[model samples]
Target: MMKRNRSCVLALCVAAALGTASLGGCSVGEALHEGVTAVAESASKAARFDVSGTIEQTTMLDNDVLTVVAESLEYRNDVAYLKLSLTNNTEGTIDVTACTGGYDANYVNDCMLSEGYFSCEIPAGETAEDEVDFSLQELQLYGIQKISVLGLGLRVVDEEYDELFKDMVEVKTLLYGSEGVDSSTFAGSIDSPALAEKLEYEFKAASTTAPDLAETDIEIPAAFLFINKDGDIAVMAELRNNTEETLRVQAGNITINGLAAYEGESWSGGTVAAGKRGVMSLRLSSVVEYGDLLFDSSKAAEDADSTEGKEGVDLSNVKEIGMTISTKDANGNTISDPVDVAFAF
Candidate 1:
C-alpha cells in the first residue's frame, strides 16, 4: 500500500508539470506579438537631453573657456569659506558664473548667502578667483551635513548672436576639513579622461554623555526637539549620578505626539554606567511624513510670537523638531518620566 501511495504522488507531480508547460507554451505568432508590444512601450518614453558631455576642473581663468576648481575650504567657530581657482582653455572669450550648493552639519540649507546657493559671473575669456562664505548657525539651522560644487553655467555673446551654456564642463574637487591646509588643487580640462575623477572628504564621528536627571532631582535643559529634514525627531538628554556610587541603569522610554517610544523596529537599547554619559536617538514615525521634518517658512511664520508692538520673535529653526525622552533604571523603574520638547515652528 505504501508503494502505491508513492507512485500516485509522483504521477500527480508529473501531471502538474505538464499542465504548467502547456500554459506557458509560446508559438511563433505569440513571440512576434510580444516583440511588437515591447517596441511600442519603448517608443512611448524618451529623454529630452543628449547627456554625452565630459566635466573637468581647472585653475587658470585666462583662457576664455574654462572650469573652476575648489582648492581649499575652512571653518572656524561658525563661519565657512571656500577658495577656488578658474582656468580658461578656449581661444575665444567665454563668460562664466559659479556658486556652492549643499547641506551643512545640522543638515540645514547652508548654501552661499544663507540661501544654500551661490552665483558669480566671470569676465569673458578671463580666469578669475573668488570665495563663498556662510555662517555655522545657518548650517546648523538647516542640518546641512554635506557640501559640494556640482557644475557651472556659461554664456557666450557676439555682436550678432548670443548663446547660453549650461553645465558645459564638470569640475571635480576634493572636500578637505579645516585641519588639512596643504593639499593639491582640484583642476582639469573638460572632456579629458582625467575629469572623471572625484575628490573625497573625510568626516569624524564623536559622542558624549550627560548628567543624570531623576524625578526628584531632574532638571530639563532649555532646549526644544524638532523634526529633521530626513523626517526624524531627535531629543538629547544628559544623565549623571550625583551620588558617589555607581548606579545601574537600563533603557529609557520616550513619548511624542501621543505616540509611545520603543515601539518601532529602529528602537535603541543599552545600559548607562555611573558618571558616564549616553545618548538616545528617537524618531516620531506617527507624526512625520517622508520630507516634512525640515523647517518650512510658512509653518515658522504661523507659529511666530505675536506680541503687539514688539520686534518679531524668532523661534529656534530646528532641523528635527517636536521630540522628547524619558529614562528608566535597571529595576525597570521610571526615571524623571517622559516630557514633550515643545516645538514653536
Candidate 2:
C-alpha cells in the first residue's frame, strides 16, 4: 500500500464534499465524504477550478451479496474524489475497505495519488453513498490541465470482520470528457523504468548538474532540479537497484544553503525491486513545515508570528543543498550507512 498520512486529507474531503468547514479550519474531514448529493455547489464555488467530467454509473462489483457502482467524480482544490454507491443486497451489514492494487487515470499517471478507499459499513438491504479522495499532485507537477478517467480498487468484508471479498476489486470509470484520450500510453507502475525516463526528461530541461551517489550495486542515474507546482524547490532522484532484494531509500539531515531544512516523508521513497528502477522525490519548501507547501501562506504567517525570536531558514536564497541518503532492506535493516552528498545548481 502507498504511504498516506497527510493531516488534512480528511479536511480537504470534508470541505469539498460537504461544502462546509473553512479550508482554514479543516484539519481532518470524515474519510468517507458521505453526503446526500454529488458535487456540492458550494464546493465548486470554493475550489480553484471545477472538473468538467462525468463518471457514468459503472458497476464495479455485482454478485449475490453486494453491488458497487461509481456514481461520479469531482475535482476541487487539487484534490479529486469519486463518489460511490454501494448496495448491500445481503442480509447483514458489510465493511468495505481499501486494500492494494491501483490503476492510472487520465492526467494522473501510475495512480500514485490514490489515498485508499474510505472504510465504511452498509446495513443490510440499504445503499450507502460516499466519496473517496485522491491527490492531484502528479497531474499538477506534470502541468496537466485535464482529467479524463478515474480508477479505483477496493475490498469488502463481512460484519464478522471476515473477508467476504478476498482480493482487491479494480474499477476503471471513464469520465465523459476523456472521449478521445488514450490513458494506456501513460499508465504504469510507479517503480517501473518509466521513472528513469521521467527524471531524465526533467533533467534535460531543468538540471544544471546530475550527481550520482556511489554505492555497491545501486546507482543514482538522474536527479532533476526544478520548482514544483507548489513553488518549492524539488529534486526528482531516480535510482536503479541492481541487487537481489527490494531496497527502500530515504533522506535524512537535509540542509539548504548550510541551514537546517525540513526533512519530511518523501513523495516517493524510491522503493524498488531487484533489477528495477524507482524514484525518490525530495523538496525544500519551508524549514518549519514537515511536508511540501501544500497549504496557503497564511499558515506560514501564523507560524512566523508564533516564533518571533527564533531564526528562520531562507529558502529563497539557496546556494547549496546537502543531505545524507540512506538505504535499507525490506525488513528495515540498514543496508549501508548514510552517505553525505552535496549539490549546487
Candidate 3:
C-alpha cells in the first residue's frame, strides 16, 4: 500500500487514504464525491438504514474558528455512518482529524472513518460535509443494542498538521428515539456462522490463579473462551478494571501443550479503560498464518512419514495453555508483577 506524507497535496493525501484514484489539486467537492463512491463500493451489499433521514441535527462543535454539526446517521451493511458538516470560520484553511476511540454505555464512541473525510481542508468561510463510517457489527457482537447516542472525539489542526487547539473536542449525537442501552437484549447474538458454532460448543478455559486486587486492580469475571472469527481462533480474556487508570494488558511466554506457542503480540487486547470491562483477545495464528499453530517443525520433520498430510499443530493435541499476564498504567509504567495464568484442556 502506498502512503503519503502530510506535506503532500492535501487532496491527493485524502485520495490515497480513501483508496480512490488520485485527484490532483481537485476541489473539496470532487474529492468528496470520489471518496463517497469508494466507500459505497467497499460496501456494495449494504442497504440504507430506515432511520437515516430522521437523525436530529446535533451540534458537535461551535466556536469562532469552526462549526461542526452531526448532520445525520446512516447504516451501510454492518457499518454505521455519521455525516458531518464543518464550516471554517477562520481566515485560514484548517484540517480536522479523528480516529477510533473508546465507547461507553450510550454509544460506540469512535469509528474507523478518519483521515479520508477530514484530511482535506475547509477553506475560510466555506462549509465541507462528508460521512464517516464505523463498525456497528462489532458493537452488536458485544450484546449492546438500542443506541441513543454516538460520540466522536475530533482534533482541529492547521494546514500543516500542527495542532490548532489545546485539547481534543468530543461530540455526541442522539439517535433511535433516545432509548437507553441494554446488553441483555441480545447477549449471545453472533452474526457469523463459524462463530455461532463455536458458541454452541461453549469453549471455555479456567485460570488456575486469581489476580491480586491490591496490585493488579483488575478482576477476571469470566473464563477465557475460544472465539472463531473468519475461521481463525482467538482466545478471549475478559477483564474488569476496578482502578481509576487505563490498564494495558498483554500476554507473554505463551505455551500450548507444554510447548512454546506463538509468542508474538496480539493487539486485539489493546487498552481497557478504568472502571470498565473490556476484552483482551489473543489469536492463535499471530505470526505464522490463520488456522495454523506454532510447533516444533524440527521434530515434525523427523517424523515426516507419520506426519504426512498434517498441516499444523492439531488442536486436539493441545492439552494445556499457559502465559504470563502483565499490565501497565496509562503512562506506560508497570503496574504489577506479571501473573502466570494457566488453563487445562
Model 2, 1-345: lDDT tens digits are 122333222223223332323433211122212220122222221112225654676787788777878777777776777677888888888876552321111113222232434566788888888776665534433323345544444566787867676333444445434544333212121222333232221121223242455563466654544331122344555556778876666666666555555443332243455554544455454333563343224434444544521344455444556667778775567787666666664
Considering lDDT, which of the candidate structures 1 and 3 is the better prediction for this target? 3
Residue-wise C-alpha lDDT for candidate 3, range 1-345, written one tens digit per residue: 111222111112222322333432311222212211111122223222223323577787788877888787776664566777888888888866553222111124321112222344677888987776544434444444434445444556777766664223434444444444433212243322332332221244545454454566667654443422122334555566677766766666666555555554432334555565554455454522431354556544464455631444443333556677777775567877667677654
Model 2, 239: alpha-carbon shift in Å?
8.9
Model 3 misplaced stretches (Cα beyond 4 Å): 1-55, 61-68, 86-128, 153-210, 227-230, 262-269, 287-312, 316-319, 343-345
> Candidate 2: lDDT over CA atoms?
0.48
RMSD (CA, Å), each prediction = 28.5, 13.0, 12.7
TM-score of decoy 1: 0.26
Runs with alpha carbons beyond 4 Å of true place in candidate 2: 1-53, 61-67, 74-81, 87-111, 114-126, 133-140, 143-149, 153-170, 173-253, 258-312, 322-343
Backbone clashes in model 3, listed as residue pairs: none
lDDT of 2 at 115: 46
Candidate 1 lDDT by residue in tens digits, 6-112? 11111111222222111111122222222111112223222111111112334422333456575555555434554556554555554444222111111111111
TM-scores, each model vs. reference: 0.26, 0.45, 0.56
Descending-TM-score candidate ranking: 3, 2, 1
